[model samples]
Target: MTSATHRSAAEIGRTATGPRPLPPLGSQSSATELSHVDTTLSNGLRVVAVRKATVPLVEVRVWIPFAGEDKLHPATAEVLAETLLTGTARRDRVEIDAELALIGGDLGTGVDPERLYVTGSALSSGLPTLLDVLGDVFTGAAYTDAEVGRERERLIERIAVSRTQPRTIAREALQKQRYGDHPATREVPEASDVEVVTPERVRALHAASVLPRGSVLVIVGDIDPQTVPGDLERALGGWASDRSAPRLPALPELTGGNVLLVPRAGAVQSQIRLSAQTVPRTDPRYAAVQLANLAYGGYFSSRLVENIREDKGYTYGAHSGFEFTDQNATVNVDADTANEVTAAALLETRYELGRLGLVPPTGEEVESVRQYAIGSLLTSTSSQSGLAGQVMALASTGLGVEWLQEHPARVAAVTEEEVAQAALDFFAPKRFTGVVVGDADLLAPKLTALGDVTVGEQD
Candidate 1:
């Protein structure tokens, strides 16, 4: 073979003039105006159907406000979601599966403290069958004793495994620290409560909480937007109630204070979770806040990750993102670091937070994150499923496809000054409070010495 020379990575990245400048981002194309209908059916379900004719498949999402203050509400709600599609009066579990399979369809149900979610998909031709199956389950799910018993045991096992996870433990501590005993904190149900859940309790909850008056149904794919609402009304006409679905009680605002040091004895690594309250998506300042978040820690190239992960090697990854609960929203930052460096990681994490406000993202940094924000929006809604999910989230907040189409313009209009202001107002170090969970013996001295940190009893 003839000998050949290869350039080093540095050489390959350079031109005669030196390092090459990156090509400018191409002009972004606006999304096609979606053909969609946003109408409330006579049966009280808000139906939003969009015609995307790109594929022969249709995606479905249902959101029902399923909140309760009862002590056993979470456990019962969990069991109800597990068995919701297991059987209906007209079809047993296997029969339900068979009918959907014949139509290239599948369905799943899940619940959290704030809402119940039923997500499904099917071939466009099978839209009628999918709606009929959904209507049947909504109106007449049996929650048979056998099905409830089996699923309860499985849920209990899953909960047991999840509760032991480091992330789960951190999440629980943070939720409690931020919200006190708000029902929204009941994200993972207690195994003891799930064990005591009976079929009767599940059915009772199904009747009381799974109403249609305050629910939303989103359908996107190759379908007629105008006709789908009529079809939904016909199929689900019986699944109605005068009582609206219950919204969760508003959460008390979070106040920043000392970080709680929760002891996870003998752990080799630690989880650092930080949170601060912020405006919801509907707020006028939200677009600016969104960009500020991306530049801070919402994206991989953010200040927090660049400082802690790339420059300092404190953690494998670090992220900050928004969490929207109903009409409320908050920014959350998290990282997992070795026990040896957890204290240092926390310091740098806060340092970056403070720097984001004081130093602020430069004009170049703002432009970079702005492009990422718009590009991600376009990418996420490029598919039928993605569009459906996006619409569902907006509809839950009383918005529709119009908001989806207009969000890019909103983001584009946010000025660099607005972003800097948002960073200063929302990302101040004094505006955050959270938890540092690790071995107290190893972490307490260094962490407590860091100030704004308090050692707590072992968890």
Candidate 2:
């Protein structure tokens, strides 16, 4: 019964019709509260057990302050971290792997200038087995000749490869400029030194610094909180040592200076690494500083990224963020660009830094960054593994579950004026000092033209 006078599809689509308006984004709410029990073992082992029953799994994080005070310690500790779990007195590498696999668990180890870390996860019921094996490896690792030789060679090779990277050169140069002969600057040891480390040296270094008396452990899982502490105490009781009788010396304070140009021969790219000391999480101003950082260069849509990456096309990425150690905190800004525009990029970078502190963020900008900060904090700890890592890392800095549960409110309460004040106090261009790594011959003319650059020792 329909008439045949209907227009074609293209003709019918010519009418002027408006689409429906979308709803505005809702305001941010409070983050999820983390519930956990905190206790200390008799031997000075800080233990925090968080109850997360979303799945039948557990995450364990053990952090040891293995301060590499000398070249020997740094090289030896590097080898030790690689070979620690390869074997134990009772369990060879094969036995250890099989034992962990049997319980649906896995283990990994890493060492930085500040600490040695052992991280793993397992089914909730297998927590006891996981702890037993970790204890065995920590207390009685069998550093056999074959295992030490193999791991040492592999580590040396990796270091050689890493040293060739421009970012690695920039990082090392920046570390030296900041810390200056301090042990904290020796995160990556010389390959020649690592090649000379013997098995006996690794065993001795382990005996000296890897003490349970000065470490912390965190466990998050679907288990009874009342019984988990007892399980941990019994499993790790015998890992006692008086070597770290009091504690390792804390990191020294860092100072900043003019940019140091580190020469890399015959290169076409430059890496800019910037650093400045900042406040710890315990400071009341921390929340405000976090928001200011997000607005400036702490996120993808920040002013620094917009200026350098999007607006000017000087670099592919530009970011600024914070780094926290046991007793020290620092802000770092990083960017890489083509050889010809290195000076221009650096100039724009400094200009943005000044602009952030001087003009500060408006109320709208502050609110956007505040929401991002709160949302990220909540999302990071939503999973068992993520929560365990967060709590454990904070525990090492003397923060607790109370801080984690309450930081969102602090971030939410930060006013625009406070964010502006934090920016002015901490983010001034004068506060930062760093290095520029590139081909010296290619970069020397323009970099020298930029002035305030000194020739630094190159890798």
Best prediction by lDDT: 1
lDDT computed for candidate 2: 0.86
Q: How much lDDT does each candidate structure score?
A: 0.93, 0.86
* TM agreement with the true structure for every prediction: 0.98, 0.93
Winning model by TM-score? 1
lDDT of 1 at 113: 96
Q: Across residues 215-305, which tens digit of lDDT does each residue of candidate 1 receive?
A: 9999999999989988998889899898999999988888788899999998899999999999998899999999999999989899988
The sequence of per-residue lDDT tens digits that candidate 2 reaches over residues 1-459 is: 887887886766565664434456577667666567888887778888888999999999999888855668778988999999999889999999998898899999999888899999999888899999988987899999999999999999999999888888889888888877777788888899998999999998888888887688888989777787788778878888655622346556656568888888888899998898889999999999999999989999899999999999999999999998886889899999999889899888888888988899988889889889999888898899989888987998888888988999999899999999999988888888999998887777787787767776555
Q: Give the C-alpha lDDT of model 1.
A: 0.93
After the best TM-score superposition of candidate 2, give how far the Cα of residue 59 lies from its true spot, in angstroms: 0.5
